[model samples]
Structure formats: C-alpha cells, structure tokens
Target: MGSKHVFVVAVIYSLCAVAVASNPCVSTCAGRPTGDYQSRNGCNVYATCVNGYICDNRPCVAGTVWDDTLKRCEMTSTTCPPNPCVTSCNGLVSGDYQSCNGCNVYVTCNAGHLIDNRPCPSTLVWDDSLRACARTSSTCS
Candidate 1:
C-alpha cells in the first residue's frame, strides 16, 4: 500500500510537470517559452514586432518619444496645436470678414471670399475688406 501511494504521487507530479511545460508562462516573472517573451524598449513593452522590427527583441526607433498621453511612440517635435484653422484671410478693411471660427473652415479665396453659402450670407461670409466679421452684403470693398 505504501509503494502504491508513492507511485500515485509520482504519477501526479509527472502530470503536473507536463502540464506546466505544455502551457505558456502565465506571468512575466517566470522566463517565457523560447520565442514567447516580449521585447523591452525604453519604458515601452511591445507584444509583437512592428514595421521591420523582429519579434521580442527590437529597440525603440530614434527621434520618437514615448507618449504617455497617446500610449504609443510619437515624434518628439510633433506639435499638437490647440485650434487648427483650415482657411485664414488677411488685409481686411473695416467691413471684411477677419476670421473663420470652428475646427475646420472651408473657404474659396476671392476678393472678399464667400464661404459656406453662395455670395455668403452676412453671418458666414469672411469679409476681407472690413478686417472683422460683417454682413456679406455690407461691402467694405
């Protein structure tokens, strides 16, 4: 009976070992399988290869700063502007539309540009003559 118990314990131990070996490491503390470990570059951990980099062993590319805000690699000089305007007009007299507001301003440049609506309405038109937003029909020019 003693020998049988020992045999059973040995069998259980062998099975547990096989199971552990067959399964991938559950935590990073234990060394990973041959090709399963991730690469560490700077403060970033890459799960897989990107661009031309090899799996589990590539360094961070130059000129790229790790962005904690975006949680990825980004160029150091990449400027995030507060408000980007697509269209801007200059040199307005008293009646011209000086600036377009909002995230995107689509405008066709003319003497005093008409934007959004045809012969743009007073509200939307950018009056180049006035140097300030004015009614399209006001006609600073």
Candidate 2:
C-alpha cells in the first residue's frame, strides 16, 4: 500500500510538471500586445535588446516580402496557388499559369497574377454545358 501511494503521487507530480511546461513559447508577463521579452529555463530571448527595445522586425530581401504563413521573405506569387486560377489552367509555377473558363475563354498567370487575358476566338464564347467553345450566335444547349 505504501509503494502504491508513492507511485500514484509520482504520477500526479509528473502530470502536473508536464502540463506546466508543455508550451515552449514564453511571453512577457504583461501579455498581449505582448511585451518585448520572453525567457525559458533562465535563457533570455531577443538578447539584442537595444535601449530596452529589440530589432525584431527585420527587413525583407529585395523583390521579396515577409510571408505570414512562412514567417519569412519570399517572392510574391502573381497568382493564387494550390488551385491556380481558372479551373482548367495549370498551377502557377515560376510566375507562369494557365486557366480556362468553359473552353475558349482563358486566363494566364505570370508571376502569380493574371496576364495575357483573352478569348481563344473573337467570334466564339465559352460554353460550360458542352465544355467547349461555341459560336457567338449559338445557344449553350
């Protein structure tokens, strides 16, 4: 019975310790609009505090901007990715893209944005029902 009690107490203490130390990030006691300092295990972060302020916001490299998702500088995409613009168009890569609406109507992306936008034929219009180009005078049916 004594040994069992000791084991139970150890397990509870371990659980408490794990819960308290689970979060890796430490924040200033002041909290949100979070202050400029945080520390863990006696090690202070942002050690380059100048005049009580740190240069946390570093400038991005030329032609690149800080990405919220990556938290780093990267070239801006001209078109949206993962589903590229215009269902039929190819995914944007190195700023090149291809997407089509219906059929003849298409959009191209250069640098992750639309460029060289036009219809495949001056007298034709996209027809979703047939999934192909149709004459301007033709009905979708």
Candidate 3:
C-alpha cells in the first residue's frame, strides 16, 4: 500500500484514551481542552471534544485539532491531513478490539494503529467468513 499523508499528532495517553475523549463529555484531545473557541494556533495536532462537541457527527482527525472558532477539525500542518481517527475503545489497548478465549486469544493494534499479528489460542483459530472462533481439530464429532 502507498502512504498518502504524514502529519504530527498529540496523543492523550494512547489510542483508547483518545477514543474515550471522543465522547460528548470529553475535555481534550491530547492536552488541549475543548471549548466554544480555540484559535488555530492554540489547537494541537489532534484533539477530541469535551462537553459534547460534535462536528458533522464526527471527531477531528489525528495530526489535526478541533478548531472551535472555525467549527471544524482542521489540519495543523500546511493543509488538512489524512484520516486522523484513531480507534480507542472500552478502556482496552488502543487496538485491542475483540477478546477471544475469554480474554486470552484476541485482536489488537500494533503501536496503537495497525493490527497486531497475535493469533488465537493454540487449539483455536479465526474463521474470517464466519467472523468467529473455531476449534482447530480437523475431526470433530
């Protein structure tokens, strides 16, 4: 795959922290707080909303910050950058989406972005079409 854009980012703690910050009550993206107005210079590279800040039903992208003055998330660089949406959820690691084998075998993000290569349990594996876990035993009764 070819890379499209490269930009700076201010992570709050990790990807998960950013996800929670996306909530209506969140106050900041990294360290920059959300309010009725924040100058472009005041905004960080990336930020979430606080007090239910909603722009087009979406949060600002990473490598950019929420511009309350402009009423949108704008790029902190030369121009609006690529998708800065980092997936943080349920207090899990930035990329740890679903758990398997009751929390042992699971999927997660590498470096809080890309999907990690960790596999399922030794006796279990993933079935993509089924989108579920299955036993590795070739012969099953």
Candidate 4:
C-alpha cells in the first residue's frame, strides 16, 4: 500500500510537470507592469500580468503566434522561438524609448508608466539615431 501511494505521488508530480510544460504561459509578474507578455515556453501563448499579479494565459488564433518583438500576435514564422522582452519603464520620462533583448523589440515610457513591448516591422530594426524603425541588422547595445 505504501508503494502504491508513492507511485501515485510520482504520477501526480509528472502530470503537473507536463501541464506546465504544455501550457506555455510561464512568467512571474512580481515587478512587471499590468499588461500582456509573450511567454517563453511557446510562441502561441502569452501571459497577462496585472499589477504584479499573474492573471491568465492567452492563446493566439489559429496559425498565429505571439510576436515578442511586436508584442502582438502574428503569423507564425519558420524560426519562431520565444524571445521575451525585458524592458522596464522605471525612471524613464514620457517620450523616451529604448530596446531590450534585441533591436527588433522596444518599449516606450508614458508619464512614468511603461507601455507595451513594440516590434519593428519585418526586415527592420530600431534605430535610436532616427528614433524609429529602420532597415538594418545592426545589433543594439
């Protein structure tokens, strides 16, 4: 009977692990703003963080996946992978812009608040000199 109980516990743990792996909405919003963020687990899943609390997992439509660079759902690409945005709006004034993670993704500040993670158009990247997306492959520092 004890062996059976142990087996059951192990099975339960394995099942939980599988669930978490397949769900793909794994993010802790402790210090993050209230908004939707692309999940690193999968391309089609996103997480909703509200006031530093996790809200729920949102899935993109059929044939679509969450674009971390654009902070929106777009058609899946051949090289789709989880590229999460790690920018913060803290200490930034309104109209300030910067990119984190990569030059293809960026964030803006609004009245001391953080905005969504925006992405440059395809084949384009963020250019701080022009303060806009431009056609280039240069890495952002």
Q: For each candidate in the order shown, give its overall lDDT on alpha carbons.
A: 0.31, 0.34, 0.36, 0.53
CA error at residue 96 for candidate 3, angstroms: 3.7
lDDT of 4 by residue, 41-97 (tens): 345556778878885448778657665556677875322332222255443334434
Q: lDDT (0-100) at residue 139 of candidate 2?
A: 17
Tell me the lDDT of model 4 at 87. Answer: 58
Q: Rank the candidates by TM-score, best first.
A: 4, 3, 2, 1
Which of candidates 1 and 2 is the stronger one according to TM-score?
Answer: 2
**How far is 32's C-alpha from truth in model 2 (Å)?**
48
Model 1 residue 28 distance off true place after TM-score fit, in angstroms: 4.0
Model 2: ten consecutive residues of lowest lDDT: 39-48
Q: After superposition, which runs of candidate 2 have C-alpha atoms over 4 Å from their true positions?
A: 1-91, 94-100, 123-141
Q: How do the predictions measure up, each by TM-score?
A: 0.17, 0.20, 0.21, 0.37
Residue range 1-141, candidate 1, lDDT tens digits: 697666444432332222223322122333333332222222122233334334532333654533333534455312211111224323211121223343112344344444532244435534332223444412222
Error of 3 at 27 (Å): 8.6
**Candidate 2 lDDT over residue span 55-121, tens digit each:** 4434445544333333334564111111112432223222222233333454544444565445657
Model 1 residue 8 CA deviation in Å: 42
Q: For model 2, give the RMSD to the true fold.
A: 22.0
lDDT of 3 by residue, 58-122 (tens): 43465455544454666632222122232333333333333323322445554445453356667
